[model samples]
Target: MMRYIGSKAATLPAIQSIIETHASGATSLCDPFAGICTVARHFKRLGMRVETGDLLWGSYMFQLATIALNEMPTFDRLTPTLELEASNESCAAILSAAQKVLAWLERSPGRPGFVTAGFSDAEGSGRRFFTQENAARIDAVRVQIAKWRDDGLIDMLEEAYLLACLLDAADRVANTAGTYMAHLKSWSRKALKPLQLRAIPIVNNHAQNCCSRTDARETAKTNVDVLYLDPPYNTRDYSFYYHLPETLVLWDGATPTGKSGVPATRRHQISDFCVRRRASSALDELLGQSSAKFVVIHYAADGLIRHDEILDMLNGRGKAQFADLKVRSYNSRVREADIKAHHRIYWCDSH
Candidate 1:
């Protein structure tokens, strides 16, 4: 999976334990702000019908590829190009297929396009997001994938899987401290390595899982068993900080005008949760509309919504309980050693 700001990969076990303890009989789980589908994936792995949605196009792509998807890609047209044998375990076969596809991509010539022009370390681009060679390789792979999809050579699931691989590959070699706000002045060893696509782990449990891109407030009206919320923690807007990965998901062909290589207008990426003034009100609206029996919210120690306020809102609706967990933060604004942060898990059963 790709690196994300609020990813719950490490602490998913603890949260899942809470959910299992509180909502054991829950049949369905809904994650409206399902960036990269981490929480939804946790529930899906447990054989629950999961509903996931996110405002970010990149996250949407990730959801489609990882959680919402029900089957491993066979790549019929690109056969043996992505070799697979049914006798092998399903996951092993998928990994083999990904290996072959990446091998093919590594042989492709570097082509020029939006990625190469905008993010490459080429002189005068003012962006050092990727090495020039790796940037060109990304453009080549992206262009090839798009061509394949446009020509109907691949189905939606296959396209999504391929794109997901590309996104992860790009993120792997990006010259930053796990963010795109500003590239490091010097390339890290990982950034200097050649870009390589690897198999992205996806869940294919036999559950009726679905994904959507919609407003969280509206989605909260959906009746579900477990409603997991992990909204923006601090002031960092993901749209601005992680815009480069999104460009591949969105495929918008526009050059950035700012020195930081971020677009001038970010209307498409604005979120009330990212604003201090609107955080509480947004939380209120979302909580009021939640139709779930159990609601689990993950918030940072320094988040805009105060501890008392969140507990009050949850308690008003049902039995609210919380636990604190010390997790390492991924704040790019600070030095690597200073990125430590803590999280609070507020679990509620509004019966």
Candidate 2:
């Protein structure tokens, strides 16, 4: 769930309330946004069938590794030998690659400069969040992981798990705030620390779950008991925020261009799905296609989609009810001061 954007951890109580109110015996849950698969994971733990899907590659990795662990291999089964060894040849190669990339980035124009990047606080040193050496090490690890995948030494599930862990570690050591576009006001000049990676243990089993990469509206055929809609709220696009990590995972050294081309792939553009007019059409399509008894749409007050508009849209179609769940969100990545606000969660039921 740590990797998903717009996690519903804050709205779980409300979500659960809606589920309890509407769900009958043996229910299945669907979260269209499905960032990090948190909602799907929660429902899975409760012995409910869960189906999660997201557009982002990283989001897919999170779901495959954490949420859809039923068919995944155990951590013990993945034994390709990756550990911190001062004399290991693989480690040496990784360190070397990182240094090269760092050197190249130093010449590029960007915030936080290359010399002062990393996740630690040793202020006053000209080092960056990632040392040239550390960057090389990470690059090397990525290479080895890819090799393992190609050789069938590891399955796609294991590869995604390892990649996610690496990304998590890199995120911690990065000098930027939570996002890559912006750096932290206070710079940290400490040497890059080693990243500890762990895989979630899989438990329980159910019928093989199904997933699709198609748009939410297109995927809604026959809804179950509960339908959880958690779309992006504010204009703060997720692709921009997590660009660095994405580059590392999906980096082909394509020479980034425009807002989405270079280091950050502007793949998850908010404009594509954030407009109010589009929301109405999408919602109507979703409701029209869904056969569920209850619909729960999680929205924010600060979003481009208004609560009144959402209620009106839902009200026009069925016997819907709206409940505002006050949620406090703290944005560590926002350029401005940490954002603290109350968001409304709308629960609409159609009998």
lDDT of 1 by residue, 142-212 (tens): 98888888877688878888888898889999988887888888888988999888877767678867777
- lDDT, each prediction: 0.81, 0.59
For candidate 2, the clash count comes to 19
Any residue pairs clashing in model 1, and if so which? none
lDDT of 2: 0.59
Residue-pair clashes per candidate = 0, 19
Tens-digit lDDT track for model 2 on 112-155?
32222232222333324465545555666666667777777677
Residue-level error in angstroms, candidate 1, position 165:
0.8
Candidate 2 stretches with Cα past 4 Å from truth are: 1-5, 24-26, 75-133, 188-192, 203-205, 256-271, 330-338
Q: How far does residue 27 in candidate 2 sit from its true spot (Å)?
A: 1.4
